[model samples]
Target: MRRVIIIVLVLLPLAVLAVWIGVRAHRLRPKSAIPAGTSATAPGPQLPSPSSCGAAGRSQLEHYDRSTVYDWLDGGAAPYLDHGFTTSTVATYRFETGGRTLTIEAAAVRFASPRGAAAQAAAETPPGAAPVPGLPGAHSTRDVLVWCRGRDMLRLVSFTPGAETSGPFAALARAWLGGTAP
Candidate 1:
């Protein structure tokens, strides 16, 4: 009986974790096509091209040309790119407001489907992060925001210590996708 109780205790958390992952995967799965000829120029449900990644141009921020390629993301962010990572665009900006200087880094990643992108976003989100204000269901890890729209995964990180950046990150996310994803 003691052995049985120990086995149940050991497996319970694993089972719960599996269920949670499964649910998240289901929630982030790609939606079905809207059918052909439904409406022209309504913005196709297809993934946005990496070349079309919008620039972050808020007045409070100074845009910088410090973009890097895929090889640079091979370290901590490599696991999140497991699902059909085609291309990515990155931008770094500096925000100075109210006697505070904050450095912001944004990356837009293109995946095969929204599910892949959302899964990547979920994978990158750390525990205790909350959903960003403007972007619903998007998480913020104190200094970073992770979100997905259509087939694009967007990440915004504040490089400055103790910088509160949920609002700016949301704005950058909007700018990166030209208003919203798809």
Candidate 2:
């Protein structure tokens, strides 16, 4: 049983990561930023391409700085990982102080509780899925998921790929809900 335990332990995190990526595929969002404690009443402008939540039809919005992201991060709905790792995001602001220069494409699934959110994320996994921002040969070292919590919160940030590691993604998530980054 020790061998099974060790295998389960080692794969546990990856399983979590897999589920994270999986559910992400189904949770496509719209561009209408919804405010908390209220239901989404309308939609906004849409970005082009895969930016659409291909299926889950989640509401979407994008921000361009860290300051905006911090507002919600401080609101208490921070991101937590499987191994007891949690984040308290301080802020999310611009590095270049200009127009958005990076693009972060994201789709989020929200929850009333952390476990609920995690379970929802896992439960909604997409079939034959891969990384959100990667291509055939590119590989990422960490599991990066862009999410937002709360109602009517916007959750998408886009920019030119060549731009710096802009906080557009963080800002997008913040504009809609609360979350963390990789």
Candidate 3:
């Protein structure tokens, strides 16, 4: 009876450890970025390929320096992630013209759901932000422009000195919605 009791205690702990490890492994596994054939998991709109953001798109816009990618997941993206933002990649450009420099950042964000994205938009809307005319799903708060369609959210920020952020936020939005790069 003594030997049996010791065996039971040891085995019980080993079983518990095994179950804990299994649960952790399942939780840590990576989820597919864009699931296939499922509306719930599908990202709303397809963002342009990074290659599409080359010179052709850059030249069409004013003050655009060059096309490159920004690490949104590491910067300024924590807040959005907290809401419902899932996978995302950002394309950035440096706009230097007329002795002024402005930074342009654009990204297509996939939220957990379309409704979640809309809710996040509403929550993040700044007070007194006006709807952008001719641009659906767009709002402008100071120098920041945020828009959403389906399950995707797009953001454009113009970092120009002073409050005068007359950059290419509109053009970028148009291009993104039109499935092009700018």
Name the best candidate (by lDDT).
1
Query: For model 2, how does the per-residue alpha-carbon lDDT over 1-182 read when each residue is reduced to its tens digit?
Result: 99999999999999999999878865765334664322222222223222221221223333222223234434423342221222222212222336432334443433334555444344333333233342221112122333323211122333343443323433333343322222
Question: RMSD, each candidate, Å?
Answer: 20.3, 21.3, 12.3
Ranking by lDDT: 1, 3, 2
* Model 1 pairs in collision: none
* Candidate 3 regions with alpha-carbon error over 4 angstroms: 1-83, 96-99, 161-167
On lDDT, the stronger of 1 and 2 is: 1
State the displacement of the C-alpha of residue 112, model 1, in Å, after optimal TM-score superposition.
1.1
In angstroms, give how far residue 29 of model 1 lies from its true place: 44
- How well does candidate 3 match the true structure in TM-score terms? 0.54
Cα error of candidate 1 at position 48, Å:
14
Give TM per candidate.
0.57, 0.24, 0.54
- Model 3: weakest 10-residue lDDT segment is 61-70
Instruction: Work out how many backbone clashes candidate 1 has.
Output: 0
Per-residue CA lDDT of model 1 for 5-94, tens digit only, reads 999999999999999999999978755554221122222223222233333232221211112223345354455456766656555666
Local distance difference test, candidate 3? 0.60
